[model samples]
Target: MAVVAVSAGIMPDGYGSDRCWLNYDRGFIWSFLGPVCCILGINAVLFIIILILLRTALSQMQHGPAHDKLIKMVVFKTLVQSVIVGLPWILGFFTRSSQALDVVFHVLNSQQGTFIFLLHCVLNEEVRKQFRSCCRRMTNKE
Candidate 1:
């Protein structure tokens, strides 16, 4: 994919040929820095803060299996969300360095929603219950 993009003239050669907001010199902030910092960095920081808050709250709240399970789920979801929503943008910085990395970045960056769906739907007990219920209903109907 990276090679195809490069061959098709889709990937900029870092030579400023296309000349747009993405041309490092012309609009570096608008194209890269702004989105990367705002979206990726902030999401990471926010998730960290959420985990800290959850930890403190858990220490204060009554200790029980339910509380622990909820906290575990929240922490897992937060970590997963942060990584999927944020970290891949960091790859944008290195996309210019290697074709392999560039293709990896594009693949990971584009699959954020798919990753979330797998996390929340396939792995989530609540969603699985709903799926089972729907299946049971269809079976009964037949």
Candidate 2:
């Protein structure tokens, strides 16, 4: 593979005439598609694990507002995590077929870090409480 890669170089050719990759034609299969498949597979396994854990936990918990809220929060967070992390990579597959999809992929891929930060911090209850505490302290000092 290394020898072939050295000979082929990273120049665009054949089907990938516009964009370059490790090889070009089949490079996407090995380089891009392989990793994407691994990531998606891992996500699928994790989601299954989460469902199993949730069922056990839910069965043990008593029915109440707190229990309901916990269920909603966990479900919502899991969904958001899946979409934010998975959607862009999924879109990447069809990006070559559609200009709009390509643009959407780029947008989502570029802001992945920001999206995660927002998910973990801005949307987090503990982070929100800390933010509120800091704001109150600053305002009281003034």
Question: Which candidate achieves the best lDDT against the true structure?
Answer: 2
TM-scores for every predicted model = 0.74, 0.78
Per-residue lDDT over 12-54 for candidate 2, one digit per residue giving the tens place of the 0 to 100 score: 3422444543334545445556667888999989998998899
Model 2, runs deviating above 4 Å = 1-17, 22-28
lDDT of 1 by residue, 1-142 (tens): 5433443364354334463334565443344455457766677677778888989988898889998898888788888877787667787677777888888888998999999999889989999999999999999999
- Stretches off by above 4 angstroms in model 1 are 1-21, 25-31
Clashing residue pairs in candidate 2 (N, C-alpha, C atoms within 3 angstroms): none
